[model samples]
Target chain A: MKKEHFQENCYVSGHTACAGCGQSMAVRIVMNTAGKDTIASNATGCLEVFSSKAPESAFGVPWIHSLFENSAAVASGVETALVHQGKKEGINVIAQAGDGGTADIGLQALSGMLERGHDVLFVCYDNEAYMNTGIQRSGSTPFSASTTTSPSGKHSTGNPRPKKPMVEICAAHHIPYSATSSIANPKDIEIKVKKALKIKGPKYLQIHVPCPLGWRSDPSQSIDVAKKAVETGLYPIVEYEYGKLTKSRKISSPKPVSEYLKLQGRFRHLLKDAKALAEVQQVADKNIEYYGLK
Target chain B: MAQAAKLCRPGVIAAYPITPQTHIVENLSQFIADGELDAKSVNVESEHSAASCVLGSQAAGVRSFTCSSSQGLILMSEVLFCIAGMRLPVMLVCANRALSAPINIWNDQQDSIAVRDAGWIQLYAENNQEAVDLIIASHKIAEDPKVMLPAMVCVDGFILTHGMEVVDIPEQKDVDEFLPPYNPPYKLDPKNPMSFGLLGTPDVYLETRYAIQKTLGDVLKMIPTVGKEYQDKFGRDSLRLIEEYKTDDAETILIAMGSVCGTIKDVVDSQRKQGKKVGLLKIVSYRPFPKQAIKKALDSAKNIGVIDKDISLGSDGALYSEVKSVISSDKKISGFIAGLGGRDIKAKTVEEIINLSEKEENSCRFIDLNKNILWEEFKTI
Candidate 1:
């Protein structure tokens, strides 16, 4: 179990994910970081549907998919079983879910897993909406973004609410470590995962993974869009320990929110509505001011 | 039920707090705290997570248990189907209670009866002692290699779960001899990395369900052998598909499940003293339905009456409908809906059902209905 051993490709190729699928990229990074002695409990979303379809699997480690909203609970059970079997010394348990599963439906189980202090790491792939169900608006969907359920219309704009502060909510559980990473920064994700796994208690890491199908971005620009999201201070990459902010990624030469929103068709309608566009910019401004990212 | 599970030496147990089932989990936690049990007890946030937690532990190759009632069981219904579909031998004790809309926290068979088709072995207990016996036997039966399906032991909410009873709990060493450590055929292991609960494409989905259906067919034969083995070790004739009382030369037999059979047996004894040729047929296993065993049990009787604590709403009782599905068309069969929502099913009610079956043919009737409520609703209609 050296770090170099974990760098080996545990998430091998040959799957059905989209060409620039951010979730599958993040999963490959995660599984490689977790190494071969790890077990994954996957939620029912794009990652599960694409990675393990029937007799085919992209994972080299043991993996299980129970339901859409019980990944964290299932991971907790796996960790407890390892302890009961007296084999919890060198294994890592990780539960991963999509944005909708994390911020909305699976929140309770995640909270229970954290509050009970299970030795597991929970990862949330923040793709902004329910992309598997054709881009329905979710709690984590950004403000003024067009989704199937929150399409722009005469009576209303697109999604009216801002993206939920899921990392803050998870940090409020007083877990040992909580951090936010992005698919744009693979090294940062690996470092944060290694750091979180060393704490010996429940840890939370939410990775900002762009969805090309749902966000309607260019297939090859997933990393570019994710980098712009972090550069614009819309998706802050920060770390917390014991409910206090320990580190925040400083945005050098901060970009405007429009630079990030223009790359995705979901926010194209906001470019015409100045007021809505300003509201979305204000969201980025508030995050930069609060997290001291600039 | 908690004591029985503890005796079985489960590796992991998880449960959330709901009425009637609350005490079972509490007792289990106490066992863990007192060092009497070496297990991990997860105090989950909801019944959904409770069921999911055990499903995970059991899938990881360990014996696991969970308990719930009423709305809690309803919340766990989604994961219950997953546990069975994945073919995990997870054990659950359902303290049966009524469903909501009126929100009654009382005794009924609706909760467990509602999820009978979730692909778990459904066992109904006649009393607290039988509930314990069923819990122990469920693990052995569900963990069998040929029949690796989840099992739920159903007990009446307040009547069996809340009531105190003198039960002959088996010793831990004896239970150890009865149920060995669960050796899962497949598991989430690093040494042998295999995936579980994968998506079933159209080419493979039908065969997966057909496999469970075929396994349950094997379970129907395995349950009685397990019950006989349990009796040989425990000295009690419990854990059978169905129990017969004085049905040999009887002309009328009243059929029911759960604790109401006690009242029916008492009524049968008094009716037999009066030379009425009355008998009782108690159903224990409800999921497999035991069509052959039930049909054979009602052979000598001329009139068959089925008493159900839960109804199917538009149709007759769930038990009555199943009984009618099996027996021949010529039999004088009747259905009686009784003891719903913790309503008492006294000896008099059983006597009324026995007398009603003698004259009624192909009728489903409701016992102990208030005439005033019926008249008021009639006028409104």
Candidate 2:
């Protein structure tokens, strides 16, 4: 631990993740916090495709990518194997996936992993939609946001459903720890990841990672978009321990949902429809009241 | 099967319950509960997780195991290919059962045959004793550094899985000596960091598959050597690729796999007792298909009757087509599809198939079909 020696990045710069990619930033922070003694089981998504392409891998730690919906199960196996080998003392196992891989297809395996009480951290990088598949609607896609599958038209206002309560669902599993953070707050993400890795059971950390390509926003504003989401009370940064809320980030002065929506093209149609705009505002208002974000 | 797996001393066992595969995992659970075996047995949520769990454990350098039945095998099919492509030496027991539309849970070979091309070594057992022997031998065979691939020991559901006989479970000390602890060449270790299951671009993806294909061909030679070594140690000759029963001097030979081979052997014995030139050629290794051994076994036969418990739907029996591909063009081979959806392939059915192969050269004949019900159903089509 010499002060002069710079800490080498676990996630290096050569990865093909797009510029200002919120998921890449979140992954870099998480990996750096977990450090070199970590093993990561990644689900098939943007992170896996961009980081581990043939002949070149961006990971500085032991990394494995299985199918789309089994990272939790695979991490459980990795933890069990390490325990079996008497090597579980200092190592950390982390399972990571996108929103679709977590809230939708991967939910069953994640539930199983948590129920089994494996000592691993499961991270869901919430990018809103299936950004790797060119922006399709997912369970985590917000209400009134237009994607390729859920397009806004005269008859419809994009995705009819609100974002899935993923952190609440994970908290319902009665795990040791579960939390929501954002790429805009890498310090919080780093602290939560470090804390979760120290607990003795499954922990969930869902990070709000805005995709510039999918959101049709400027790449430079990716962190700004994520910050606006938290400031508007739409994506409340919160934490739960043993199915009970322990903490939440308060919005000192809550901004209008329009400020967050106006930055991204996916929500452009909502501005044209007053009813849809109000509905979107209602989602943020409800979150603000429920989690006491304001 | 559970005793054999326990003897192999797998560091991890993960499985989900489905039909006849349940008993195998249940027994393993009991062993773990009783402290008879020191292992981590994970009861996963589904067959897909069961397979993936073992894949993760095996990739982390522990010998892992899982078992499933028809639908469960199909559910685990994707991960089966992944485990093979990643070159993990995991062992699985496939209690073969019929697939559902009608939803029958009885014994059938259709399930294991369905995943023949998933790159796992597929071994079919004719009885419980052979099932036990194969489970133990598969660990050694699959764990060889030269042939590091996942293996499936396919035991017929309810037939070998549920049926009990006096099986000589090997001593744990002997099994340990026979099959040493699995030492993987590469693993998920922080001490020596490595990335596995990476996206193989066009430049490397094709060669990775080619390596597996080439290794499987090498496995065809290595199985007999391992089988002979096992026989030398255990005094049972049950792990050969194909078993020849009086095929040398027979005019007609019947080929089959799994527990149905027991019935074929019984019919073959009676036919030989009556001075008939009939024999049995049981397929033990179904995946590398045993083409050369099959070609050698059927060299002198005038007629070959392949009693397949599964079919290729539009074409013919899978085994019959494979057998036909290896043999000379002059050989008369008839495929008899029977015991589908767990319809009993009785001794009478085997006799009928033998008689039919002599007079006709039918490719996909459904034996023991109730013609009245079939024609009644066929009228609508």
Candidate 3:
């Protein structure tokens, strides 16, 4: 099918998401690219609760909402079922969850799905925190980022650890494709998603999505923040295939983590703490040096 | 005459072996190996995979089955909700066993009870016969277009699963007649392909859940019809939901589920001769929780007590809480926690519960509490 045909009106119009919700836009683009021949398994998170309220649907394609975890497992089941029915050809299975859902709650299921090598694409829209549940800190919540559960105060710092390296974890499974993308660059996300679809075995794509509500940033700044995340080398856009890092976005001079952190209130506390700021910079430098983005 | 049922009914049989539940997978594997069943038998590494395997298989528009026990069932907990929410009519045989800490491998309802709200329809079996029959019925009920939700059949761990009775296994032809070939309304077919799960915004998420709720509500209605059809095919009449035992004139009734119901029935019969107005209400279908039948069964009893083989930690028994919710309007039912951790729930224990219910005082008591243990006494010393 033509890419334009795949793009024709898949995600339902009139969603209840906040203005410039990165996850909403990411799902819309992904679903459109997935086309009509694709089945989606969504885990419980901002994307699921916001789009699938009772009596209404933001999905024009057939859809299922499992739990906070196990979206990949559910997607695997769908793939297996199709294979059993002699319908595995051309049909694509996509499992989508947010950072909280994938990095923390869904890690095992996602690992299992990738390890099993099912013909499916698993996407982790990394919004950092558990945005659907009042911004609780998740495993994907970055270091020095304040959340309801991991608040920054005199006694305690914000989330004191770097986010779990999910793409690396996916890579460890030796799947056919694993990538990290950002909503800041739709073309990049679309290219990676399209590339993932072509790979025979399981594919994983971690999409950096800025959450206004959880990040305590302006809604309209979603894409901009996501872009700054890439530019700052805090969230490098990279892809791996066959257990090897195949590609990464080039950045001649990476911006400082402070530039990315300065825009959000969740990271506002980190500005005052010189030690925490240094630690955050260390994380960014590590990502930039590790992915060779600079 | 006992006849063999076709194993071909299930398009996919995904399972992980646990005590008591080993037989279901063993038998299914045998059938598949022997070519008696034309299905894929996925021996999953974990119960989680087993449940997930069935979920994916079901979404592909095929009949699926899985089996698990206490820890195994608990491990499958997360996927259970997914199977139900995805509206896939997958069937599972949960061989009931005690939850751990002390680690008992015997019979109890704690495992299935932990997953009470996982959105799957749950059924309890009183005997090996019911275990086999209810499994077939579960497939029918789950696969029903109106009831496109996963279903679980709970058989007492060693009580029924290990205890092999002279079960009149239905003829494959009869079972086929009773349960037609499962053709899913929507499947992942390339020709008429569709998405199984999609991203939903808030404007539509509740609607998806409502649809699941509506389907489950519909399953409650469809279960009876499926059970009746099975009964017509096989000469055994199964109570599609709750089964009442001599409860008509009883002033006090003991409510229980799983294989314990049989033991409770025997106890009730012996007590009835002693002039005790005691009866037994065996909850067969735990989910789509037979609210009306439960209310009717316990409505007339002067004192009602629910014997729970499962505990909900700080709260009362899960089954007891559900029973209380059902009988909230008219009854003041007592909750009894007993026979946990695969502990032998002797007939005397059930009889004691019934006797306790008869009293105006001591209504809700832990039946088998270790009286020798006293936290306050220990702390003072």
True contacts kept of 2: 0.79
Per-residue lDDT of B1-381 in model 1, one digit per residue for the tens? Answer: 889989988989999999888899999999999999999999899999999999989988889999999999999999999999999999999999988978988999999998998999999999989998999988898998888899999999999998889998899889999999899889889887888888888989999889988888888898789999999999876888899999988889989999999888988898889999989999998977799999998889899999988899988899999998999877889999888888889888888888889996755688887667676656442
lDDT, ranked from best to worst: 2, 1, 3
Across all candidates, the chain A TM-score values are 0.96, 0.97, 0.96
Best by lDDT: 2
Task: For residues B247-321, write the lDDT of model 3, one tens digit per residue.
Answer: 998888889888888889999899899988889898888888888888888767878888888877778888888
Model 2, A162-279: lDDT tens digits are 9999999999998989999999888999999989988988999999999999999889999899999999999999999999999999998999999999999999998878888999
Model 1, C-alpha of A290: deviation from truth (Å):
0.7
Q: Interface RMSD for each candidate model?
A: 0.6, 0.6, 3.7
Q: Which candidate number has the best DockQ? A: 2
CA lDDT of every candidate: 0.90, 0.91, 0.80
Clashing pairs in 2: none
Better of 1 and 2 by TM-score: 2
Our model 2 lands, by Cα RMSD against the true structure, at 2.1
lDDT of 2 by residue, B240-337 (tens): 99999989999999999989988988999999999999999999998777888999999889999998889889999999998988999888999999
The fraction of reference A/B contacts recovered in model 3 reads 0.50
Model 3 misplacement above 4 A: A1-7, A146-158, A212-225, A255-279, B1-8, B26-36, B40-53, B71-87, B113-120, B185-225, B239-256, B261-283, B286-338, B345-362, B365-381
Model 1, position A53: C-alpha lDDT score: 87
Ranking by DockQ: 2, 1, 3
